[model samples]
Target: MRQRVQIEGRQLEVSNLDKVLFPEVGFTKAQVIDYYVRIAPVLLPHVAQRPVTFTRWPSGVDGQAFFEKNSARHAPEWVRSVTVPSPGSSRGRETLDMVLLSAVPDLAWSANLAALEVHVPQWQVDGAGVAQLPDLLVLDLDPGPGTGVVECAEVAHRLRDQLVADGLDPVVKTSGSKGLQVYAPIECADREHPSRYAKALAQELTRQTPEEVVWRMEKALRPGKVLVDWSQNNTAKTTVAPYSLRARPLATVSTPLRWAEVDALRGGADPESVRFRTDDVLTRVAEHGDLFDVADRTRAVLPAV
Candidate 1:
């Protein structure tokens, strides 16, 4: 049976199929409740009006649409989405979708999500015309157990600087878990192009941070450091769908964090040490633009490789 539960006044539907998908991830409902309580404040503002869904699959939550839909609503003027064929082979598999949120609009504070839904009749997917998508692109910087938040933040700061130097605008947000996310806006292009641009940016960022960050594309080489994955930029790749409950059994989510909280974690604080409600960081961003503006200062040294 599918059950609908409310968190922070938002309603979510969870299906029994979700439990069947992950029997080993083991997390109690109480733990999942705690996780939601912790992440809601920081993540809500970025995706308040967007419709989101959670997938209880064994692999992970499907976050592409969550990001796409929300980015469309908050920053549509600058971002867009591209639809592609679903990659799964099973009969009746859901159609695969991808989006691009652009940040190149000339207008000030006008970046909103621009979306494109591809019709996959053969796959039973319906197309929605250019509409609002989400504005957040998260690079979950998961460093191993021994790596602290400071080390991760230092690397995140460096990565943001590298992206800005490449002529891309990036913002830093704490993952509210063990790592950080360096989000950049995709401006003035369709979905396909932004994915390409994001991939280029990810690759270049990893190349510049060989000591602290490891590009996950090379699995054999990523033994002990942070994984700077470019695959997420691929149209087919999916992330933790925003607002979706993670299969962490306890329902931990991919929530956002405040800069101060991020700094606290960097200083050896626990991941749960700080909690933010939705839009709290966005409010801060509104007051002080782009947390990762150092990118503007170091542009000459790190030209897009």
Candidate 2:
């Protein structure tokens, strides 16, 4: 089923509203559209200047999913887009035409297409359509087998303290999957500063606590440890955008957190406590407002390790 809706004066045709996107909770495509629209006030600011790469799961969470970096050729003219260089494209294409979801209508369009996850790079495109240097640094803490969100949270606290010592203010968020991602705003002159800073800190943490932290990406080396994935800072890599839905069984969101919440997780709070569903997140926004808006405006230069 398709229905024409007008949002911010932009009309869109949303389809298959009744189709289930999260099978475990029976969350439907219509609910997904509603979540995106209602969350737009806070979400759009974070998404505005960034190029979005959508993870579409037309067949629901348990079914097949595919990543789409290039916006569809048939996309509406009103849908904003930007072309960015893709040196690692397997298709041998020099660039990708990515969607820039700046408004509620753009999000509704993506949700209609079953885009369950929204991913964006640390850097954003400038007014001239040029990809700028990264304005933020990220450390993706992923727990391996025999580990979970609690372990990741513990590691996040360690990382956060170190970031504070270095004079940068870092924030925490759930990956909306099996980990926590810590991000800090940084004013860097070039592309390599963020990645280099993250690698140094990850290595430092690994050295200080070899029993709990691992910086490498190799799966075999990660058992019983939280991998501080510094590689997501790469220009080619994209992290799941804050507040984007995960393609999980329960439709968890990549929700931002107050450090107090991370502290609770470290103090043995239930892992399920961090897993927020669509409705839960809406309530959270209503209560707390955007916890991550500071990261977008605050900036500090990387300090030598």
Candidate 3:
């Protein structure tokens, strides 16, 4: 059975099944509720009006089990599952409830699915379409386990400033996990091209912060600090499906944040540290709409590339 948990005036339904899922990842019911409250707004726009499937599992299921189920299924277009893998596993297992599934528009879906395959190989795609992916791309800056929020925000700010200097409008958002996602739109005829653009942008960020961040493409030599993943740009790479539930211990929803909050959170404030009862963040997004100024950025960067 599912019960309603209210966060910041938003209502979300949590299933009895979630009790099993939560403990496996070290989250309590209230924390789970808090996560949804904070992230739902960010995810809503990407998943708006789309049909999705929720993948669930019992608490004791191991990572291998989680991986097999997802790899074996023919999920709907809009459905993806999140997983909570066991710690210390070299090959990350697909823990249940770690991914989100959605039926994105054909163009965006095709592009995103292609991207997903590149970034995460465990996922499977069941359908195809001729739609093009969005030119707005994101380069996720993931701070490793021990890093703090201040460092994350500083890197994000620097990256954004660099984009602006380069004549692109870059926007920032919280991953609702451990890091920040910097997004910028590009002018591309199809999804394949955006990955290359995103990679170039990531290279620039890494060059600026060689001490703090390492791009994932150089995997064997990863510095074990933060990772600047350009793979999200790959036409076959997939990000947390917008609105797809994450396998966070508290089941945090990967949501978007405003620029001011992004700035504030960088200085020790928690960007993903939000509650369902807080209207402050949602109010800010309502005022700002989406973060990337696509038209301006595209015009500036496309010609140079």
Candidate 4:
């Protein structure tokens, strides 16, 4: 049921590799591991030194699923892990230890769990065991019924414009679902908080385009608008790390999009213009390199509150 895979010099246990994950596409566990192996060059940078959360589908994507936060029990001893206080664990006194994926073996082993979706917090843990400040602020743009990625694309453009005006460079990506997420790297000594700044920006952006953007999470307000989920920037919150494969029936990936692609969609491009699958993503990296390299940008500072 399980096999030891030797990659480079490290070894990993890959099990249930023939099991189908995406029934419609016949995607299997083997493919999942391969995807991670191929995407590691681009993904490791984003996930390195950050705590990881796993959404496991042991049987398959259509089967029952569970989330795993602590990986030490299942992870190899060589894997790097850190424990941080749970979101509000009695005022942060309690803590939970988790694996930090920094290499190919870490990812391949995680793939064995059918972890189709991987999420990570914005903060990185320092060797001193402190959770450092968030370097990236993410805004999740989720579409409601009657709207599509097209609408989300438009909203993303407007959001990007607003962020640029604020002196920050933001990158847009398909959520690998029917939504989009924008990641902006912010660095400013004047503001040490991420949640407050992200929330204020989302609310302000909603005010500028009330008809198409909804900052509140109320369902009734989402019909024709993209929900600007600023809450993802909270310290305890997590967003799907870039290059993560979404647990979709279609085996889609949370792909980084060049601003031109988003602009094209808003200008009448087809829906698949931004949608990418495993093969498509590998090819993309081969040609364009890592498009999300801006995620490490530290030059643009957030405006003081």
TM-score of each: 0.51, 0.97, 0.58, 0.94
Indicate the TM-score of model 1: 0.51
Model 3, span 1-305: residue lDDT tens? 75654433434444543344445555443343343444444544453322222333334223211322233143333434433332233245544332332322221222222111111221222233222445556778777655655567777787777677767666665565677777765555554565666677667767876777777655554544567777766543346544334555554444455567667876667544542122444454567654433334454443234
Higher-lDDT candidate of 2 and 4 = 2
For model 1, how does the per-residue alpha-carbon lDDT over 1-305 read when each residue is reduced to its tens digit? 65665533434444432233223544333333333444344333333322222222323222233223222233332234444444443236454333331121211111111111111010111245323332333455667545655667766766666666666565555444456666665432343454555566566666876766666555565555677555554333445433324334233434344456556665778755433332443445456544444224322222222
* RMSD per model, one decimal: 10.9, 1.3, 9.2, 2.0
Model 2 clashing residue pairs (backbone): none
- Where is model 1 more than 4 Å wrong at Cα? 1-53, 57-84, 88-137, 144-149, 164-177, 188-190, 267-305
lDDT of 4: 0.85
Candidate 4: give the clashing pairs: none
What's model 1's overall lDDT?
0.42
Candidate 4 similarity to native, TM-score: 0.94
Ranking by TM-score: 2, 4, 3, 1
For residue 241, give model 4's deviation from the true position in Å. 0.8
Best by lDDT: 2
Best by TM-score: 2
